[model samples]
Target: MPSVTVRNVPDEVHRAIRVRAAQHGRSIEAEMREILESAVKPQGRVKLGSLLAEVGRKAKLTDEELGTFESVRDKTPARAASFE
Candidate 1:
């Protein structure tokens, strides 16, 4: 895991973060991590599954048509190629 060092944060900001952490019942470090994660990766971000489902709807693909992929899927493991 990687670590980050934030230097020279204003005293007021630090105090506010401490108070927020206490309110949320989380350690200051854990609260900071949650804040950073949400800042970069918010709840409103488009997700892969939602995007694929939207594409399927636009394409008018039926559930039965999608289910056919499972029946026709090849589950065999591929063999390593030999160089002779």
Candidate 2:
């Protein structure tokens, strides 16, 4: 197995990890492993169009309102770019 050595961790941070490990009934090494795994996990992006469609389906937006939202979204990039 490959080994890693993490250096210069603050004393308070180490103490907090020890407390959290005991709270979860896990060894500090096991707790650190789990934390690292979760912290480094990749996340997926949700498409705005798909998300809006889902919300519209659930909450019932009119065609005019949906069109207005798309129009506003389209112009937002241009408006944002003007500031830059």
Candidate 3:
């Protein structure tokens, strides 16, 4: 097993960690290990598109409400630029 050293932890934070360790019936080192493990575990990305699709299905969204960005595009005429 690999060992890690954390330096200059605040007294208040250390006290809180100790209190939490006691509550969980674990040594401070064990509690810290658990916390470190949980913190480093791989987390999945929030899929906004899938989430929106589910939400839209639940909400019974209309075709118009499921809008595209074309309507919001810049409608101004394009100008020709000259470089001499």
Q: Write the residue-wise lDDT of candidate 2 on 1-84 in tens digits.
A: 567779999999999999999999999998899889888866675777879878986888888877787777753442334654
Most lDDT-accurate candidate:
1
Kindly provide the TM-score of model 1 when superposed on the true structure, using C-alpha atoms: 0.59
Better of 2 and 3 by lDDT: 2
Residue 75 in model 3: lDDT: 66
Backbone clash pairs for candidate 2 read: none
Q: State which candidate, 1 or 2, has the greater TM-score.
A: 1
- Whole-model lDDT values for every prediction: 0.86, 0.83, 0.82
Q: Which regions of candidate 1 deviate over 4 angstroms? A: 54-84
Instruction: List the lowest-lDDT window of 10 residues for candidate 2.
Output: 75-84
Q: After superposition, how far is residue 33 of candidate 2 from its true place, in Å?
A: 0.5
lDDT of 1 by residue, 9-29 (tens): 999999999999999999999
lDDT: the better of candidates 1 and 2: 1
lDDT of 2 at 72: 71
- Using TM-score as the measure, the top candidate is 1
Superposition error at 41 for model 3 (Å): 1.2
Q: After TM-score superposition, what is the CA distance of residue 59 in candidate 2 from its true location, in Å?
A: 29
Clashes, model 3: 0
- Where is model 3 poorest over a 10-residue stretch in terms of lDDT? 66-75
- Alpha carbon lDDT at 34, candidate 1: 88
Per-model C-alpha RMSD: 8.5, 11.2, 14.9
